[model samples]
Target: MDIQTLAARVDEIWAGEEAADARELVKQALDLLNSGAIRVAERVGGEWTVNEWVKKAVLLHFRYSDNREMTAGPIEWFDKVALKTNWREAKVRSVPTAIARYGSFIEEGAVLMPCYINIGARVGAGTMIDTWSTVGSCAQVGKNCHISGGVGIGGVLEPLQASPVIIEDDVFFGARGEAAEGVIIEEGAVLAMGCYVAGSTKIYSVPEGRELPPGRIPARSVCVPGALASRDGSHQTYAIIIKKYRDERTDARTALTSILREGI
Candidate 1:
């Protein structure tokens, strides 16, 4: 079936309007997602559009499918979703212990190292998901991005309409950094080590001397973890401070060496 028909079927099933067998429809939608033909979300006309039907299909699939034993090398798993296994054909370079669920898409030239990428996540071309990083469901990672070691890119499946974390192109997320709750890290942003930002986290721009809207790290920004004084001056609350926009010096410091990505 075409995307439109598939979407309609899934939506009907979601609304308790379809009595037909849903397994095939759900599988078809998941197959499309696995092949990168459709995404949980996509940028359309400069805005990210959430495909609710696609997400519904994912949830429905969980209901329709049963847990099964799956193995890669000596490791084993029992889960409702199957792991992706077409790395060579997809032109993705995945190192040991890298696990991506069936519905996620890893574009060509991306490298995965000991990472866990949940269903509905997208790792863009030429990007590197470093060791111990977790890319949550429906999170959108852009091209040439560096998700550093131990970073947490949160995902959401509940409340159906909640936005996924969005990391735009050429971003350098430092080690142990965390971006959750639908945060949008704009293009070329360089987050310092250990920085954390959530939907309600205060983001202060030092140059502008003002607080930016929450959950958005501005384009080409250099972000560092900081704190602000409380009203009573008793303690400081965690915040992300934008030191400056990326420049030659910043680029030099955050540049991903070509040598590391040569094979990918």
Candidate 2:
């Protein structure tokens, strides 16, 4: 079925309507997701558009499927979703302990180093998911981005209306950085290590001496963890400071070598 028809079917299933081929329909949606034919969210006309129906399909899958045992070498597990096993065909290089669940699309030329990618996520080509990092369910990461070690890119399934985290192309997310609650790290942004961003996290633009919109890191920004005094002048709270835009020096520091992206 085309995306339009699939979307309608997913909506119907989500509404508790019984379709004789409900499970099949859900499987088709997942298959599309796995092949990168569809995404839970994508940029259209320079704005991020969330596909609520796709998210609904993912939720419906959990309800319709049953958990079972799965084993990989000495690793035995029981789960509702299956792990992806097509690294060679996908042209993705995955180091030991790297795992990506079924229904996630990992484009060719990407490298996974002891990382975890959950269902409904889409990782673009030439990206690197570093050791101990996690690309959460439904999070959309674009091309040539670096998800550094121990970073957490948040995902959302419940509240079907909630948006998943979006990390655009050329982003350099430093080690231990966390982006959650539908926060958008725009293209070419460089986040320093340990930076945390959420829907309500304050983002102060140092150059402008003003606060930018919450939940968004502007393009080409160089951000770091910071603190600001509360409105009441009573206490300090965590914040993200946009120190400057990325420059040649910044690019050199965060450069992702082509050699590292090559070969299994």
Candidate 3:
């Protein structure tokens, strides 16, 4: 069935009454998710849009699911969602203890190093989710990105209408950092360790020499933690763009590594 057809079925089943093929529809939706045929959200015309129906289908899946016990080499799990087993076909390198829930997609050349990927999340090709990092529910990560250790890419499921976190291609997230609450990290940006980006966090631009607006970090930005000093001598946490790349052909990794150390 087409996405629209599945969407319509989900809406019909969600409205108080259950359809005779509700389980089958939910199964089809999850099957698509497992095969990487559909995503929870995508960028269109430079703007990110939530595929609400897909999220609805994910929510509906939970309603139809029940807890069951699963054993893996002495590790026992009792959960409604089963772990994905198609990594070999997808060419994803998942280390031991790396956990990815059902209804999520991990594309080719992606490495999961003891990380956690929640439901409805889409991790793109050539990306690396390092140890202890989390790709939260419905979060969308783009291709060739490096999500460093202990990072958190937030989910969007509670309100059901909220947008998921969008991490664009070629981005690098340092250890222990968080990009949450509908924040958008554009392509080629590098976030230093301990940096936190949320909807309300202030971002300062170094090349432009001003404070950028919240929610979106511009493309090719090299961001590091900074202190927004108050006039009365107090300070608050913030991210500063220490540098911005003009071309992808440039040696970004070396430049970013040097730039991130400038503030420290």
Q: Which one is best on TM-score?
A: 2
Error of 1 at 36 (Å): 0.7
> Residues 1-264, candidate 2, lDDT per residue (tens digit)?
789999998999899899999999999999899899999998899999999999998888888789999987898999899888889999999898999999999999999999999999999999999999999999999999999999999879754438999999999999999999999999999999999999999999988889988989999999999998999999999999999999999999999999998775
RMSD of each: 1.4, 1.0, 5.4
RMSD of 2: 1.0
Tens-digit lDDT string for candidate 3 (12-84):
8878665889989988998898778988888889788888878888998888999999999898989889889
* C-alpha lDDT (0 to 100) for residue 170 of candidate 3: 81
TM-score of candidate 1 against the unseen true structure: 0.96
Ten-residue stretch with the least lDDT total in model 3: 255-264
lDDT of 1 by residue, 161-194 (tens): 4788999999999999999988899889999999
Q: Candidates 2 and 3: which is better by lDDT?
A: 2
lDDT of 3: 0.83
Q: Model 3, 223: alpha-carbon shift in Å? A: 0.3
Compared with the true structure, all predictions reach lDDT values of 0.91, 0.93, 0.83
Better of 1 and 2 by TM-score: 2
| TM-score of every candidate | 0.96, 0.98, 0.89
Compute the lDDT of residue 18 as modeled in candidate 3: 58
